[model samples]
Target: MSRENSLVSAQWVEEHLDDQNVVLIEVDEDTSSYDKGHIRGAIKLDWTTDLQDQVRRDFLNKEQFEALLSSHGVGNDHTVVLYGGNNNWFAAYAYWYFKLYGHQDVKLLDGGRKKWELDSRELTDEVPDRAATTYVAQEQDRSIRAFRDEVVAAIGSHNLVDVRSPDEYAGRLLAPAHLPQEQSQRAGHVPTSVNVPWSKNANDDGTFKSDEELQKLYAEVGFDESKDTIALCRIGERSSLTWFVLQELLGKKNVKNYDGSWTEYGSLVGVPIALGDEPGQADGKSA
Candidate 1:
């Protein structure tokens, strides 16, 4: 069996393309990219369709998750390698969801699709045939996910990181250009949450930074082993990248992703929200 870690380089994936035990998944917000060209034999997993609960504002249930995986020929024993466009935002989000459902052997392609393109690697339009297999996913792990009430209760006691851009964090923009519906009635971060854009965790080439650099980046924001951390973004997609960096790269054990994120938290009635560029405060008032 091939040894697996939280991340694997593009070259590593290239060498493992033929490994029957390794399943390559291309998870992207834009499925059109997969149709154009993708890593050879890679199966496309559309983040919006395959992973999400179409009617609800949550991920698919355990049975739905299993069906999705089985249809993609992903048995529990296979080493799932994921990568995609938009700096691997949805890819990392998928990684987090896989873990939440207890898929132990999941890994992300280092630098994601950007690094792959930069290296001038081979791409193919031919989709390979994959046999369906029975996949049993563990029950959804609530420990890694935080609900809006839990976030509200932990307001002053826990560490919350808002991994959106400065404009969104400052209440200047409702949401990103592409996801207009993800916007909240109120435009701001959760009260007392720190603004630490998720992009800081990666290099310009889309690769994650070195351990030393990652340590410093979080330390600057007072991330310590003692604090139980919760991270959020527009709809909790981008923050999954931060969640992976903190938990997988930094080895912080008590980190959770508030998947409900700003859309749910900011729109819900009676929830106290913080606005503006200020770093810390319990309410929208500047600290």
Candidate 2:
């Protein structure tokens, strides 16, 4: 997908605010962020509740997704524009979800809430009243999703990108510095995976770096642009941004986001785990 189609500017969103076919959505790591204030007419989707299966540690089923979208007034043909805080971290995750369910028109608001606030754009606590529609979602598309088995098989072969902080990649922390350091039984990253923090892809104002810069960023990390790639983090939200960069912005075809990520892989029994920075050795030992 071209960047023109997958990414939209704040100005574009403002211009299309009155369009009946465009739906604005806000998804944030902090679910309460939307309740404080959001772009006018934008609906909120709580990543912790709305996007996940309540009982299982998986995403919602097809029927559940259809129900969620239908309840949110999202139609099959609506153009979904997602934005949220933290450089659109959770927003990108929601965007990936839309693609996995075969939504034809979905785009991210560039820079997300960060940029919009920086520009002093309008925000409101007033929630819009939208009529519900029967939103039909397609069966889950497995092509863009990578499971733990695939991640293990990709060792030293596919491009395994560890999009986390240096501390997490080096086994110094289990999660981001701000979040609670918990989840996995083990620390460190997958074998042969390079540490490229997802935050590097965004500018100070939260806008993504230019395509040229993004290409160079991965090139410097020894990513094989032509090879199949799997991006991972503590969970999967952060890596979804990188997935969008490689697949949507750069137009690479074979990139997938490993949503199971460290939380699943690090806790697996007898699985090879690499420690320290610099990708470690291919044998999954500490560097």
Where is the poorest 10-residue window by lDDT in model 2? 278-287
For candidate 2, write residues 172-200 as lDDT tens digits. 99988888876637998899999999988
User: Model 1 Cα displacement at 176 (Å)?
Assistant: 2.5
For residues 133-199, could you state the per-residue lDDT of candidate 1 as single tens digits?
9999999888788888888887877888899998999888888756664542888888878888999
Cand. 2 TM to true fold: 0.98
The CA lDDT of each predicted structure is: 0.87, 0.93
Worst 10 residues of 1 by lDDT: 176-185
RMSD (CA, Å), candidate 2 to true, equals: 1.0
